[model samples]
Target chain A: MATIKVLAKCCGVSVATVSNILNNKPGASAKTRKLVLEMAEQLNYTPNIVAKNLKMQKTRSIGVIAEDMTIFSIPDIIDGITDYCQKQEYQILLTNLRLFKKYNDTYYNKDDYYELVRQEIKKLMEKQVEGIIYVAAHERVIRCIPDNLPIPAVMAYGYSKSRKIPSVVVDDVGGAAGIVKYLLDQGHKKVGVITGKTDSLHAQARLIGYQQVLYQNKILYDPGLVAEGDWTRESGYRCAGELLEKGVSAIFAMNDLMAGGVYDRVEELKQTIGEEISVAGYDDRELSGYYHPPLTTVSLPLHDIGYKASEWMIELLNGGELENAGENVCAVDCMLLIRKSVKDIT
Target chain B: MATIKVLAKCCGVSVATVSNILNNKPGASAKTRKLVLEMAEQLNYTPNIVAKNLKMQKTRSIGVIAEDMTIFSIPDIIDGITDYCQKQEYQILLTNLRLFKKYNDTYYNKDDYYELVRQEIKKLMEKQVEGIIYVAAHERVIRCIPDNLPIPAVMAYGYSKSRKIPSVVVDDVGGAAGIVKYLLDQGHKKVGVITGKTDSLHAQARLIGYQQVLYQNKILYDPGLVAEGDWTRESGYRCAGELLEKGVSAIFAMNDLMAGGVYDRVEELKQTIGEEISVAGYDDRELSGYYHPPLTTVSLPLHDIGYKASEWMIELLNGGELENAGENVCAVDCMLLIRKSVKDIT
Candidate 1:
């Protein structure tokens, strides 16, 4: 807790001289600097970082606002960001808004929700964060952006509807298309689909991808072969049961959890996966790799998205020009992890 | 960014008069205070929080070092901490060390591991956190308290080996005993157990609880009926298979993931759970309620632990004496959630 005044008094010099020597500013003689430093060490002087930050106008810290932390994907994304920040010697001020719970509350209207988010941003600003990163709990279009923000901001796992803020998102459509095409190339015909909530943007985009592949293969798109699911294992189970009744040879579930439900139903019917019926899933979650037959699924590059978002924030902080500052949408590719679940019809 | 100096100059008042009036210090007349405040508001002066914190010698912020964020129980604990901090108007500086990965590295010796942890603590200190909370990835005895720590530190979900630091942990033995007693009351005498890694503190404590009940009921302890698992569904599946071969009527898997594996094996062998054989699990994870026949498990009070740990830190900061400061261990009781997984053998 020793201060500059105490060190200066002990070294028989002015406080400014001791401060200059400590800050490595020229003007203090070598002999004087050496004597001041020795006195500081002897006194166990610890500099006040708050004063230093105020003077420099920078804290070397970034604010990360996570919409919710319970979501399985958000943690991995945060891990990626943390890794990058640690290597750069930057600190993170993380605020979990629990927006998922608020969005479900009837008393909190849309305006109230936005107001809550604005309050969170203001709190971070008061902490003097140089930049901010908004992480969405789910992959959806975000419409709320505080007006006239002074600091650099970026979005991850979601984008702003106004297209005025930069974002890093997964190529959901391409991932769906690639997985469906892989199934088609394996000589599978009459493929059934378990779509996510019909209102979901991801669900609609993935459905379009499935239809496009079917059309290119000269196969007629059958609406009866598609059943709607709510991205739950039970929904997947019910939808897969309905699809089985339609006598489809293959089933493409939009997510791995639903695919697990499909597996459960297949086993119930005295049938084996990858043989009696081919199954594929998306979002290659951790459990997918250990699923009974292993799951053939698409891996969402969440880590890369998180890493790239931090990179963009750092770039903006360094006074680098952002390409397409407004309407800037960076899409990362999804990888297909072909495991033991898909049958080799060829 | 208007400074008080600018406001004072614009209002034609001395800086000391403006400062005293703005701070509501005594000796400033009401009329003078009103005039200074009106002028400051008109000038849109925003007080520099950094300077204020420097003068106060406190940041009103706490550092939370999460050993790993991917663990299922961690997010809920963090959510509890965030909820409490938000209510108390305290900011949290979050740092994810990803120590689980580091512990697995062969090159990272004991000293290196502690050094890494010390480095994380130093970073938070640089941020001027008033207190520190260390969140362990799992429940165990920790030995890595940095030497000569200068801040008040607490642990959540783990304890220090020296017992010098306070910790909040679930009553693992009591929770296990309560659930097993419930099973015994249902008239199941021949019970089997699937335990986690023997080296784990939770595993050993839970095992002791299980044996205590058996001894109380005059049922001889049978090591042959116990199978060791690695806390994974696969290990549960394999161990359950071995236990089933011994014709045990009731099985208690130490965790829900392993309980899930037990369910898979039971179905594979064409046996109905909760009827031919009863199954129970611990750590009532998210999917436990959705499992087929639903799982009867022990719910760890993670939220309460988190809330209490923060309460302890805040108390320490308020200069309140920590009860039993060193060797202080606070244990919260776990609740037993009874579902359809346990059968009425009576």
Candidate 2:
């Protein structure tokens, strides 16, 4: 059967008008609404009442706001959100803000790009989206949110500085501390920790967690064991190789991609993971499970974070007071996936 | 000055209503419209005409449709799309069809995952998204696309059976072949290939490219020299180690993650990567440059692929025919990133 979409196009009306008429909503001119019905009838458009109810008070939509859409964590978080929303009959409206880098300073700039994005958001808003989920790619608190939105806003993966919204985040500090403690518990006295960009707030928290864990365990924090990576695999390989040559028994690589690199270089030096030297990684991406020795890594609950973020947004939209003074701070726990990569150094 | 958003909220009317009273759109009831106008003055919500014009009929958004959100490619392509779109004042609306899976009778079941995916797509249609970009976690054609969509759609990191929908894909075959050919040119007779998933279209293409390049140059294809991996660094390490036991002189990993794994295993075996067995990888992820002795890889031009996909979707939306019918393929060239991974066998 032809869909209402075809009917809308044939009659030259927005799908919204066709939906309003089909669902018997209050808006829509009688003339235009009559044309939609006629076209739908001729095309045999089957109206889905289940979808109609889901659409009611909802654009049947949600938005994911993120910087750097390509980060590994995004997909899992999105997967979690999508799975939950779809079960509830909701569609997602994705917004890639790409605010990680400066635009005008780069190569291309076009007016159509700006105009089109604004139009899409306005379109979603006009459809009266029930809730909006902001999926930030990093840990930066956004200060430039558009005030044009009328629906409830929520953050996932990253959050805002203001408490006016709710957010879901991984316990970066707790997760990092767990990794460090894992290394120490395995009896690796000299543990090395690689970090992402020092300026990153999440990275900073991880670093603190690593240090605190070591200090509490009675192991003096060694500056020699600290190195930095750009969150790239090569950086992990290089930094870990440099540290490995110094004879550290266990290594903690931040994020799995970098851990992959460290794993590569460690093997290159004739060291067997979990045998000659123990190694651990973070952000248990799916690929991590397949990595050799299957990378003993930390599993960040990305999907749970996204799901919780959306759930919180729904609550906030309904006028519920989220914790942190209407600013929901959701800290999803991270699990350590023990593969063959770590050794019992004790 | 107060924004129109705050003023409209305070006046208990819609932003569109206030905008209508300001822009003089024809359809508002006179009394309510008058109240909106007077309230805007009292609340000092002097409309920023420039911002308003920017917003007028503009959603400042684009929509992204991905197969699985967590794949390695989607986020990067999104990073590129967002980088470009954000600069143009466009935001991205992200949606994932969650369609990448081995289709079977289970998939066709009404409550099945794939069917649920179609239901989600129907919901995205109701949101009135102006355009859509499809991204896959891996490079290949997806089997779960719904029969119809109401907006312009483009595919990235994947292709469509119908040429009407434009797509952007990397030349995995060519890129993999190029790396193998480089090993051949280096005087290595026993070259091994560490492949990704055996059923993956991209993996099959790379194998074809490897065989084509090797046979054309008069080298024999050995089944013993080929190993299959699911494209993880650990798999690479295992596969490479297996190939090493068989005494292959060089290896070509399907992607960078696998290549890194090969390097790790080689080090563990006390065999140097570049000095003993030459290694190469596809997809010049950031770490390829910083790897010890660096790494030799093929560039996938991910961001470019995303940008071009958007451009193609716009063209299709405007009713333009694809440049070629038989060759509707847009294969991005792979640039050889020569690093320390490969060595001269002669």
Candidate 3:
């Protein structure tokens, strides 16, 4: 925080002499330069970029504030963001909030967290970043980005709730529908479903997708076949038995972690998945491939969501209108990975 | 690159008027301020921070160069870096090289990658970061950081091969020895070894650790009991059968992925993992916990390595001598996680 004048006074040298040495300009002898340099360090003479408040302009750098780097969804989203930004020769000034590590999953529910985000935003603004991108660990209605922010801001993997900040999230409805359609096509009329936590938007949308597929097929949707799960492998295992007792030929789990539970239940019943009973899961986690039969699942468009978020940011920076101005949200489609877990009974 | 003079000329205003308008200082009329701002934006005016090169001092920011964020090791490392930095109130300017995505695993073996790193370094230097921390995806003798660099640089999860640039890496030797010692204490004689690729420093160090344990226990080392695995599950499976045939009671896999292969081979023989064949794995990956009986493995000190790397960087920045200045390479200890996979024969 010290100025060159202060450093000069302490070192018994002229301000111009201290400036010359600090700027690497010739004129000061090596001894004077070393003395001035050491003194400058001692005084913490930081020429802060906040000085740019006087004249800061296009930094060609986007400030990315991630909820937590340790979260599973964050890395891929960041990868996608960096991939696109690098292509545009735009630099990334990253700030990891470490919210999850500090507060666990309940951080978002806290009111003070939003204020924390605003602080990070203010710091990035001081650094003169052209735009801002907030990467969330989970998809939810996150109102962290202020509606009246001066610069452009985009949300990745979560809803911002404000029209000013565009949000990019996974198309959970389409993803579940696509996978369920494949399961029905495999000759499974009575397909059991393991739903995620009741409160999750993902769970609700995926259930709608399943109901829509059954409606189109003219099959009466059986509420009995839908067993509640909390998105854990144990919950999936607990729900699978009820569905199997209901005579469903195949089971669809909301996420791969729960699907692993279904496998555990099926194996316990002396039934092999993909043969006696087909299983399909959403979220093709890396562990899904290592599953005994390899799970047939949906891979969330996480990377694409990040890419789209940055695309919207760069567009806004370039003075272009957001592509999803009408809805203010972009839902990226998930890919159906047909591994060995789904059996073709037909 | 547009200067205030150019912006003022374009706005048809005096330089002071333009400066006052851009700096949000009162004096300029609203209409005049709007015109000046519009002209500044049009000129791609950025009050470039590089102008600080004239007198830039302590920015209290460190540049972190990550090889790839998509790698499993990177996020946690970055998390640790952020953890230490936030506590110290220092900012991080992150540059994700995305080397694994661009050049695959062979990037380290390539000649051009070093030049790519130097370019990134230059960009960070221009941003006036006081220090640099390079996070490598894999451990190796990396000479990417130049010795002539003015500011200090630290290597995380890899060796810099430079005394000036302190390196923080996993204590693979100690990690392996600790787990192997646990296995030996369980009354398991004739423990078989499955090593990673021969070229890896991690694999070599781990192998030495296994050997050290055997020698300390007064057990003769047998080359036949050691099987070469290229850090793949398939290779682990291939070697598991051979080690089992050689009549070893327990297997020490170099990594968890390879241990998963051992599980596969054990199941093929219609035997339960812990009951029939005890297994201890390295790098306690997330998937290892999901493995059937779970896995007993060594948890790498990735987060600690990152924390130590930043500690070294801050020390160098604060003019404090590095604690490990004598060795220049500080190998942080790994934690032993006991899960269901390893059985006590005693």
Which one is best on TM-score?
1
The chain A TM-scores for the candidates, taken one by one, are 0.87, 0.75, 0.84
Per-residue lDDT over B1-346 for candidate 1, one digit per residue giving the tens place of the 0 to 100 score: 5777888888788889988887778877788788889988776566766677888888988999888776777877887787777778888888887776667633234678777777778778767888888888778776676635677888899986655468888898899899999999998988999999998889999999999988888889999989999999999999999999998999999999899899999988888999898999999887777677889999999878888888888988898987866558888899999999999989
Which candidate would rank higher by lDDT, 1 or 2?
1
Model 1 pairs in collision? none
lDDT of the candidates, in the order given: 0.84, 0.72, 0.88
Per-residue accuracy of model 3 over B268-310 as CA lDDT, tens digit each: 9999998989999999788899998999999988888889888
TM-score of 3: 0.85
Better model by lDDT: candidate 2 vs candidate 3: 3
**Could you tell me the interface RMSD of model 1?**
2.0
By TM-score rank, best first, the candidates go: 1, 3, 2
RMSD per candidate (Å) reads 3.3, 7.9, 9.2
lDDT of 1: 0.84
Clash pairs, candidate 3, are A57-B46, A57-B47, A58-B46
Q: Summarize candidate 1's per-residue lDDT along A1-346 as a digit string, tens digits.
A: 5667888899999989988888899999999989998888787676766678998998888999888777778887888788787778778888888766657633124778778888888778877888889888777777666645778888899877655468888888888889999999988888999999998877987898899898888899999999999999999999999999999888999998899899989989989999989999999877677667888999988878888888888888999967766558987889988998889788
Expressed as tens digits, the lDDT of each residue in A143-178 for candidate 2 is 444444556777787766656666688898999999
DockQ of 1: 0.53
Better of 1 and 3 by TM-score: 1
For model 2, residues B168-269, the per-residue Cα lDDT tens digits are: 788877888888888899999998889999988878989999999989899888999999988887799889878988999898998888988888888778
Worst-scoring 10-residue span by lDDT in model 1 chain A: A100-109
